[model samples]
Target chain A: MLDFTGIEKERLRARWVSSAEAPEFVEEVNAFIDTLKELGPSPLKAAVEAKKEEQKEAPA
Target chain B: MIETIKQHVAGLLTEKKIAGFLGLIEKNGHVAPHLFKDGESLAGFTLGDRKTAGDARYPLNKTLVTLSRAYPEETFGVLVRGCDERGLYGLFRLNQLTEDRVIPVGFSCPAELSEACECRKPYPDSLVAGEKTESSQLKKVAEMDGKDLARRFDFWTAQFVKCVKCYGCRDVCPMCFCKECSLECEDLVAKGDLPVEVPVFHLTRAMHMADRCVDCGLCDEACPSDIPLRLLYKKTAQIMDTDYGFTSGLNKNERSPLSQMGPAK
Candidate 1:
């Protein structure tokens, strides 16, 4: 669905980690974070920031 | 066609086959859903035709859900297009209405109506009247699929921005029988906000509808935002069909794959 909405397929990741394997979970998280860093912030960030700015600028 | 339906419904009503026939009525040049308690009231019955036949549609199944709840003992006959029969199958699965308590009086859509709706199935399994037409391909959805991701994003963003948060789509949907709606949840969606979390709001709805959507197109017509919601749901339905090997709202025995508590295949 994210792919359908133009978000890069790399933006979201899923992995099954056992609760007993803390080290494996850490490794998976680190790997996903590295991938995200390479992808940079989502394009939706700028649009959301702009919306917040517009809301702030509006008279209370 | 209307005459045949009236006679059939009349026979059902008189024979105690149905407690009432739930169908659209034309009164004072206006069309609305009404329950005919007996054959004599057939004078006001219509095929929901106005300027065009098979227009002036209503979510009669939603009404049926309420009616069934009030009088669980009674059986009812209702007007059914292909989409509506699909909804009945869905409703039965959801436990909103039982198959035994409802009888369908099926009719096929006019060619123009079928074309306009881009209906996949324009007629039910059987029709009491009107010739069956071929199913329509989702032309708009196909067009959207051919676009690059960037163009798709921009198109959807602009469409979602027009939302006034009226919730007309949910209200008008027969499948939307949930007492508590996730859309209205304050945590998921911030209240008192215009253009509410554009992607999240609609995506949530699309995800929820993936398993349940009957491809009725009522949501598209009800949208005050004029969002092509049916197209979105249709796209999701395609994914559900191709990936999970399930076409939604088809059989009473089949449960939505998502509804089953198990690991994805």
Candidate 2:
């Protein structure tokens, strides 16, 4: 997770919560969802989709 | 200088110190890496002219690795420039070859060649020939540093788009010794893609190179598209130095910080 943190910082987040801390885990998940919504779709995903469409539209 | 190197190599061969001496040989006006088994064959040996750096350059360390693996008990000697010595240190750290098994005959690069390579250390650890000169700085990275994030991203993407996915960079690297490379992993990098996923391909390599890259500049030399790979890996080396005062090929006993499992001390 620390390695991935360097590449997609905004998209990926790591939180420390033990199995006993259900409430804390839920809170962290909710916060991450909000962050993702604010950040919108990843540019890499968008690029891949756009490339797929371009390939589909190209001549056979 | 060439005569001195030839004499030293002949001495090593005659003394039975090394089974074979891996050095450049000029035959039919073409210079290539060859293994001289005896002093008789040493007559064909030539220290490639310093005028053409590219012609003189070959992955001698890589050949040493291959030969050493085949003949584990047999010792070998090789001619090494500054970059080659650094690469040898990296290989030693990786446990690819023992220091005792490979004898390095060191030489320094000329000032012009050093400037052209943007080399930091123009001579090896123990210089047998040539004089040590100051290391040169890479101007391309400095130029890129002035650009904004978006501009830099665009610049890199445009440069990466020219890639034909030849993997010449990997093939030519002396320190790349992985049996199964992450670059070839289909899950990470798709197959048969002409340009490959630009970020996934390049960034993945850059991350892997952070601790391993010795600033040899071989990747940049091998790239047919003229992609500034040395600059990218140099940035990784800088990051490693800043975050954890570690640089590749500095000392054989010191392992790369990234290679450790726990947090940096």
Candidate 3:
């Protein structure tokens, strides 16, 4: 799992990339897509199930 | 601000650069977002104080998303304040817009707005005019963090009770691009009452905000009930920060945690 701490430290680097740099933007985004290849599918099932149980326990 | 924006607007249109520009226009002493076509009369184009609008939420973000989808081939420029710029970034991440098709005319908001909205960066990467200033806004999330759990619950409950169900919150949100909303989901939130009962409606909105909300405060402004929806979403953002250490709309390259899974390879 990726450490959550490093995420905020990452700077939002934005420049005035022109239409001519469209290819560069595409390449950069595509490269970013490759980095997240290992995180796999969302782990929301457990979270959602726990939430439902908690909701059931709490008075509605 | 309006005079400078007008000159820029006139220049862009005269150059035949963009099909239309989106910005606030003074309408009956209230500021509302309007699509300004190149040749249209410019009399109505003026920026007004957001506070006097009564309805704090500016629908510019929603307008851009809708227009971008409707006219994909045409180029559109928008006068984006910091919040609007973040909203645009969120829309871009969702594939609602491409970088080349939209021009973000950054306008540095006054300190009052930045403080009121608790804004971090009051400038965009590319700006047309105005100097960036230090933000004086208090982070509501930080304030809420000081409160006890019971107090937080009571605070939100009382706020939610005022909702008029105007749907202006969702309607004005730049990130709320979905045709069908979870708030309208039959299984989750009930639809009849104004200011939905307790956790269902607001919590549902909060859950959806996990990695989605950009903290624009437009939702809070749009709410007729004056609910601090931004605080709840900010809390959710803070939680995401705990596990994922990420915030929304700051990075154009980062894929939202909710939309994608795995490492940042």
For candidate 2, what is the DockQ-based docking class?
A: incorrect
> Of the candidates numbered 1 and 2, which has the greater lDDT value?
1
Candidate 2 vs candidate 3: which has greater TM-score?
2
| lDDT of candidate 1 over B1-265, digit per residue (tens) | 8888888888889999999999999899999999999645688888878888666889999999999999999999999998899899888888899899999999998888888888878888757887888887778877887999888877777667667799999999998989999999998998989777868898899999998899888899899768888878988998998888787776556788888887655
Candidate 1 vs 2: which has more DockQ:
1
How many clashes in each structure?
0, 0, 8
- Model 3 misses residue A17 by how many Å? 47
Pull out the clashing pairs in model 3. A35-B264, A35-B265, A36-B263, A36-B265, A38-B262, A39-B262, A39-B263, A40-B262
All candidates in order of lDDT, best leading:
1, 2, 3
DockQ of each: 0.40, 0.15, 0.02
Q: Could you give candidate 3's per-residue lDDT for residues B1-265 as a string of tens digits?
A: 6678788887887787889888778788767778888778778775545554223446576787779779989888888777677777877787878878988877777766677677767766556777885765446666776766545544555555556677788877778877798778767667685436454566667777777788878787667767778877877777777778777876666677777678642
Error of 2 at B37 (Å): 1.8
Q: Estimate each model's TM-score.
A: 0.92, 0.85, 0.74
Candidate 2, superposed: residue stretches over 4 Å from native: A1-60, B47-51
Model 2: per-residue Cα lDDT over B1-92, one tens digit each: 77888888888889999988899888887788999887465766766664575445788888899999999999999998888888899999
Alpha carbon deviation, residue B116, candidate 2 (Å): 2.8
